[model samples]
Target chain A: MIAKPLALSLLLGALAVVPAAAQVKIGVVTSSSGPIALVGIPQKNSVALLPKSAGGQSIEYIALDDASDPTATVTAFKKLISEEKVDAIIGPSGTPNAMGVINFAAESGTPMLAPVGSAAIILPMTEPKKWVFKTTQNDGLVADKLIEHMVKTGIKTVGFIGTADPYGDNWLKVFTEGATAKGIKVVTAERFQRQDTSLTAQGLKVTASRPDAVLIAAPGSSSVLPETTLFDQGYRGKIYQTHGAALPDFLKLGGKKVEGTILAASLMLVLDDIPDTNVSKKLAVDYVAAYEKAYGTKPATFGANVYDAGLMLQSVIPVALKTAKPGTPEFRAALRTALEGVKELAGTQGVYNLSPEDHSGFDQRGLELITVSGGQWKLLK
Target chain B: MNMQIVMLLGQDGVTNGAVYALLALSIMLVFSVTRILLIPQGEFVAFAALTMAAMQSGRAVQLGWLVFALAVVATLMDAAKVWRSKGREPWPHGTLGLLAVAALALVLTKVLPLDRIGMFAQALLTIALVVPLGPLLYRVFFQAIAAAHSLVLLIVSIAVHVALVGTGLLMFGPEGGKTEPFSDAFFEIGPAMIASQTLWVIAATLALMGGLWVFFGKTLYGRALQATAVNRLGAELVGISPDLAGRASFTLAAAIGVLSGILIAPITTIYYDSGFIISLKGFVGAIIGGLTSFPVAALGALFIGQAEAFSTFWASSYKEVIVFTLLLPVLVWRSLAHTRVEDEE
Candidate 1:
């Protein structure tokens, strides 16, 4: 009796230690706290809301919350794959995080897609890691639109407030080069970390220089944008903040002052008038209703991104399941191949037309200028 | 000095430096009196601004004047009691207390129709609440963790700040409290910006310094504090309780920090990490002054502030690099090394 019980206990322990044997599980990882946590929380909700039954398969999600650390992102992905035995993965979480986790996908041949990774990360990856894909808008496209807006407004001689991270820094670099080429004086370029609370040090410098208007290439963190607070403490100037500032969290936390704050976001979100070609309005109503039903509050842009990421994963799973099998390398490759066919899919933003070269899925036309008018977003024509 | 350089320097660095100096003094006062560094000095700044924004008073709560006066009086009484209990009668206690009161005065001066209280008032209110709030912090976590080593204490204190900040983030949301530009003040000095808010912080810091001089050099308890700092056991023999010294230090530090918060908040903008940054800069100021010399620390702050201004003007993006570079030479010199200031009385 002792031998039988001991053997059974040993067997159970081994099973627990081993990767769960060949059950269809999709791994999802994203940040959940710190400055990015505000955005990350929505991403978590997206993973949680991924349909329980998709394509007649009971898809199980191996979810991990990265908590905004690059180190944590890799570790979380590793846990989902090795321990949870997830057949496929969805993530990159953000640009830096996306860049950080590529090696795992590269080496393990575990097909992965970066839902929110910058285009730079996806563009640079070689054919070997063709499994890697991304869904975030490109900084170059954002920069192009920002430049166009500045040119249209006849606002010359602008300044850029950059962050220390790759996300904001990349956008700032592109905007700076683009704006400078357009004869706009790149007055001042400064940086602060995503976690930094006060932007006064930087704002004071930028405003003192007397830039015509400030173009903020900041991350999507409430703590990082010192522009609104700077305006309150007496720095006055026109602002063209990035999509990072587009979230309602910025407006809600920033309050009244967030009015007239100009930012570019994916098309079809919060537009007063319907766009010529879009689906977010039709889907937005239902998405908002469903989100409210599920989460009690209207979902943020971050939530929408994650929710769409789940949907994207769901779409790819059907095509992949046809060719891929449980515990097979061909299965992961098939999943990767199926994801590449994601063309002209109507996303919350606009039609995401993805190809080998076009990883961001949408271009400048896919975005629109959102002005916070009367405490709500009104997309400018 | 070249006028061009001076103008640029003033424009680039002076306003922020003024605020940094005030925060540094708050940190030094706590160290000078209690031989303890208040880690929550920054949180003090954050809370004051947050409270200022939240309360939007001077009229909302009835008899705003009374609540303001009571808060000031309570501060004075608390500071006074701590001093007297140690038989030192901290004369500067009321002066520092008054600094906190002035912060309240700022909110009052701006208070109009309840809804009309602009964001700067909210900013000032943030500074005010943040200022006194730090003392309450001493009554919390670190009071028990005081016996830990300096690094451990620092880590614990930082952890406390992060936890408090995170809690604030959850409650307030990522959108920071709104602030309006301080109205009714302008001290134009060439290219650099000096508004009522900046001027207020500078005045508060300087006045407190002068008051501190009187407290230390001219008064009985002030002298006792010096004695207590030098030799606590000897102070007791001569007549001073060590416990009083600690409480006085905590109250004085909080009062000073509140003034710093109030003075700085309007110009700097009240955000969750606002106070923490001030504390960091203040520590730098203290270190530059060898942590023992008040006048030296103040001077160090001014020099650092000016340098910061100059660096920003000349090398806007590399301003931090310049300040850190300045610290390197200061650090290398033995004369600038930190000296353990004996806290007696």
Candidate 2:
């Protein structure tokens, strides 16, 4: 009688463990505080809105804060993969943090969906980056559009002022290549720290070069300083900013000084004005309405990248679940394959069509030009 | 470079150097008076700037309440100390002055229509709220350990700086702030047009330096501060209270920091921790002067500003490296030239 009871108990325990292992886990690492919190907080909030279950399988998300640090990002990634045994990871916003973990994720066969705005993270689709994908539009695509606008407006020479970090280096490379390809001479390349209080020296140096147009390549509020200084010094030339200035606070802080500044941003920023036929229009409207209803404020463009990553994972988990159990290494590989096979899926930023060679799946159609007219972003005609 | 370029660079450098010079002077003052390095000096700059930006934007800043609370804590501490000493010393005059300043700040922040006021008045209100924080900080954190070893005091200062930075994040949030230019008029000087704000920086720095010169050379209190800085124990023996001098030095440092913040906020976006690096740059200038001579420190800071401007033009990526690397050679020379004085154990 004792032996029969023991066998029945063991069978019940074994049955419980099998179903628990089938529940899919997704890990997220993003900066929720510190200097980059402007982007991180929104990303964190959006991830919370993801559906709890997909295709009859329960889904669990484990989100961690990286504090906008590359070291913390790596630590979070390691803990999630090894300790939590998450099948896939999303985010570690900012280019440097995302790039820091790409190799590890690829070598470990754990799929990562990075939400930063750098193309270099997924470009040249090599062996190490095969497991890594990004949701934001590529910097190269945005840079090309900005340069094209400049060329059309008779801008011959341009000055570039960016931060002295990997993000800035990426911009320098992309903008330089894009401008040079368009036959526009980049007269001066000046760099500043993101926390810099004054860019007077940089302003003087760049203005002295007398470029017809200047690209203030720093992100968020840091971008305003160079432009304001150059304007104050009486450099009456056209200025272009990157998509990083999409947040409305950039205008509140910049005030009247930012008026007339043009930038290449995702169409989601001005959802009402986006062409109805654009692939991203319906997705943008839906996202804006859902996000506004949830957060009581219009979502930042950076948050859209995180939301898109969530959608990507939601679409892939069902297909991957059909092949293998959730916690096994084979299941992680299956998820990676499914993510790469994603096709014609419309997201808030653009329609993602992932492939072995193109991880971002965004092209020139992903961005639009907008100008700050009267404390509002106006779509360029 | 052409004459026009040279003029523009010079203007930029001088304006930046003037702000650095004020910071250097304040650092020198605090170090010589108390033997404690004020590491959070730059935090005061950021706090003042953000507070002003908030006030100017029609937001009722909490700085007034913060100052009021600190003043209350500092006053109670003073009262307790006096009671323990059997009321031998009269109720502290500095405490009374702080209470008065705090009350004024409370009224100004609460009663005044900050948005209707001009930028100048808004800046003055910011200065008023920020300046009293200095002596209050001294009373709360340093007064009890005024005679502690310089290294210990320096550690405390770093702790204070880190704590303030955290608080700053909570108070100001992570987003950076920029204020409208105090004056938008442009004045053409020789080959370049200079913003009037730059001119204001130069004028304010010079005026403050001159005021300091007069105070040191003429007044009894100034002489007492100088004497205390020269020989702390001796000045104490001569009946000049070291506590008073320390408080005065901190007050002056706080004023200088707030002034610099107000001047620079319109030109650059300032975040919470931005002050620490700016302070480090000023410390470099102070070190070049051996932290003693005001003129040499001012000159060193000016050189740093000019060098930074020129370096950005030549090699933008290496500007900070160039500014920091300058300290190495100067430090080596100072060590070789001056005889080391070991502290008595």
Candidate 3:
């Protein structure tokens, strides 16, 4: 009887001890069901494709949905840090949602990988922002490439139409500065809500300005509207779009109207045409293939943003493991340090070379100039 | 802005105004008859537009299944209510009819080559699929609590709207869709060019409003509905069923909502959650009408559309702010104009 009781107690104690030291816990928060669901759904789905085991340690992810509400994102971050004790956290996909959780993640000493568009999350490098890293290319980097193409094409004047949100505000700021530096004039700047039923007024105003080219800055499929409206309004000037319009739906929705539209986005769009030697090309292809196999559709670049976060964690976990054990404050700090030390780490979006001052360390290699030709994304040679 | 710009903006405003006018009428009709705010009226618009887009893209429309599911739940609730009132109830004929309508719609979607069918047939099929949902929703969510306070009803309406938005996301996914235009032709008037789709929207709205006018003025059922809207107890004493009035008004509201959706789908890209803002504008119009006057509501919606368009031209970022601010003056005027206090029964 004594032997049986002792054996049972031993078994219970072993079961409890094994899981605590065996797995690395990571929490994921995504706005999978609200206004920004266009960006959040894919990121939520990509959580399934993240590496299950990294650096010989099994990983467990606790995923939560914030419904695109900023307050909900903060609550989710707090719960993940205090209740689940995750070593790292990924997502809360919208720029606004990601911006809301920086202080919480910093207070908890947890590393956060935000897959949002704005560069403001890491720019100026505050103490709180140092703990946050962005997965997507910065608006300024993409804007520079666009400005280069505009100069090459001898475009003199450009009209700007963007959403009244952070994504558009940041793009406007960066594009205005870059265009002014390059001697290109921005004639008219207009804004619209994502849910607006019509853009005829904005389209008319932009067309009346009579710029050589018009640039539309909005995220997801919402970017297709201003262009289509412009096309319908008899504006035949060249149209330029931001990386936000890089999704396949842009082609499907714009159809024949979007022909000759220029943009700068990730290599994932032209994976078939990109050189095989490119650092991120192979990984992007593999990710696309795996996602298609699992979901029966190609993954959007937004999903790849989350998957790249997984890749970053995969590379840094081993380095952090040498310093401290998982599920502790020291381990999270070590993970943050290891992430900052990441150099020439290729992800689906781009190569990440993080530093103490720059949390979103990406250069020109991160984005490519792309255009729509014959209803498909084509590399602009 | 020049004359050309003014004319162009005015044309855009008129097109959007017609759709908003239809929404305002429906909202007023539903509120007057059912005493419910009908917040999810916008979901009908979104569902119809998305269903039409799905048909055009050759995807199997999932709205039929949603209608069928709502029907089943509603039928079960009705049967339970009947069993409680009278120990044993016979087969539910009313529910059976709704189920058959849902099943037929499902079968038609599967059997018809939706993409190849002409736009008219596709639209008719979408209307058939989406209209029954209004009555089913009325039955499932509102009939039992029909006697609740207006605030309670508004709260329920909000919940239904949120639930439908989530269901819309699950059914349609997150991408916005736009259908092919009815015609690519444009007519130039002076310095402005108006697309044929704009004319179609205006014509359809006029026809719908005319039909409503005739229905209320010339038909006995319409007068009965009017009576119920005016005095529920008096109508009930005269043997008019408030339940039938509620169903009829919801049916009318759904029809208007779907037609509005079909009209606007080609002119703009519409997402699953786009209907709330559109309907909110209609609600603003309804409030302007004091929730009773149809003509005033329709005119109010038109004013909103024009104000919104001009504001977009002047200060695009503050378009919504300008349009919604119009409501404050109207509300103040309405309060001063009507000082008689009425008590809720």
For DockQ, the strongest prediction is 3
What candidate 3 keeps of the native contacts, as a fraction, is 0.56
Q: List candidate 2 segments past 4 Å from native.
A: A1-24, A50-53, A56-60, A276-279, A282-299, B59-113, B239-241, B340-345
Q: Write down the C-alpha DockQ for each prediction.
A: 0.10, 0.26, 0.38
TM-score of 1: 0.77
Q: Give the local distance difference test score of model 1.
A: 0.62
| Residue A65 lDDT, candidate 2, scale 0-100 | 80
TM-score of each: 0.77, 0.89, 0.96
Q: Model 3's CAPRI class?
A: acceptable
Predicted chain A of candidate 1: TM-score: 0.86
The residue pairs that clash in candidate 3, if any, are none
TM-score sort, best first: 3, 2, 1
Q: After superposition, how far is residue A282 of candidate 3 from its true place, in Å?
A: 1.5
Count of steric clashes across candidates, in order: 33, 0, 0
- Candidates ranked, most accurate by lDDT first: 3, 2, 1
Ranking by DockQ: 3, 2, 1
Chain A only: TM-score per candidate: 0.86, 0.90, 0.94
The lDDT leader among the candidates is: 3
User: iRMS value of model 2?
Assistant: 16.5
Per-residue CA lDDT of model 1 for A62-167, tens digit only, reads 6676756889889987887777667777774677787788888767668776766356677775865576776667777777787888888898877677766676
**Candidate 2 lDDT by residue in tens digits, A1-381:** 122223322222121011234388888887866668777867877776665677788888888887788998999899989998989999888888988999889878899999987888888788889989999888888898899899899999999999887768889998998898889999999998887666777887888789999998876667777877787777889999999888877788878777899999888777778769987798778877887888677778888889889888889888998999998899999998998899998788878889998899887777889998888999999
The per-residue C-alpha lDDT of model 3 at residue B121 equals 98
Return whichever of 1 and 2 wins on lDDT: 2
What's the TM-score, to 2 decimals, of chain B in model 1?
A: 0.70
